[model samples]
Target: MLDGILAARPRGFSLAARYVAFALLASTLNLLVQMAVMGLYHGPWALLLAMAAGTAAGLAPKFLLDKYWIFYDRAPGRLRGLRQFILYGLLSVVTTLLFWAFEITFHWLGDGGPLRYVGAALGLGLGYWAKYHLDRHMVFGRA
Candidate 1:
């Protein structure tokens, strides 16, 4: 579905635009998953569980979209693709820390309420921005 949309983009539609669109979609999915998880589980582990579920929900789609759309790179084989995914995960560590910092801070300050999502959104935005450059230069060899 999104692949078709990306494929049918106008000639003037820039790569940045597509990337942003994909990011927004992935972020939305992440947030939605977080909301659902938090809604379902209000136990002591609500924040932890929600964040884990949200990140898991968002990751695979983002990777596939980035691999096929943003960088337009194909994995040569199974092992190489796994290696690429692993490298991508490693590069994400720093950004993930940034996100966790914001999220945990807000969660603490706001008593684990809506403000946490605000922090998460901000963190994810910044993280995605940095992640793009990292993935471009390091993972995709497009520097």
Candidate 2:
């Protein structure tokens, strides 16, 4: 059963896993920067700004990784890399809006430092899902 389940899973999931890891690392770095330099903590505006920055930060590495490693297609005139970037940028905005919405909702929920971080995590995860699927198929696929 376990082997069957594993076999049934899409290979894109593995690629997505790597993409998520890299994005998380970038996001974490961005978050730390916002916290240390900007001194933002547990506020809706602060979280939104931090996440926006983090999303932008994540895009660079994510693009490189997805192009060279994850999708790994080598066609001289494909132009998918550049197209992927633009699509990903648009999707990133959607993700950012979703994250901001969640952050605002969480802020309305209550005041707890740890919970705020959890809210951030939730938002990041949501964005990651969209990015992974879109990158795997739309951005990288030949079809």
Give the candidate number with the greatest TM-score: 1
lDDT of 2 by residue, 8-72 (tens): 42355666476667778866865665555337465566655665666566677666655665666
Candidate 2 TM-score versus the reference: 0.69
lDDT of 2: 0.64
What is the TM-score (0 to 1) of candidate 1?
0.87
Worst 10 residues of 2 by lDDT: 2-11
- Candidate 1 has its poorest 10 consecutive residues by lDDT at 3-12
Segments in model 2 whose C-alpha atoms lie over 4 Å from true places: 1-17, 40-47, 77-80
Cα lDDT tens digits, model 1, 19-68, are 88888998899889989988899999888888878888888788877887
Off by over 4 Å in 1: 1-11
lDDT for each candidate structure: 0.84, 0.64
The per-residue C-alpha lDDT of model 2 at residue 126 equals 86
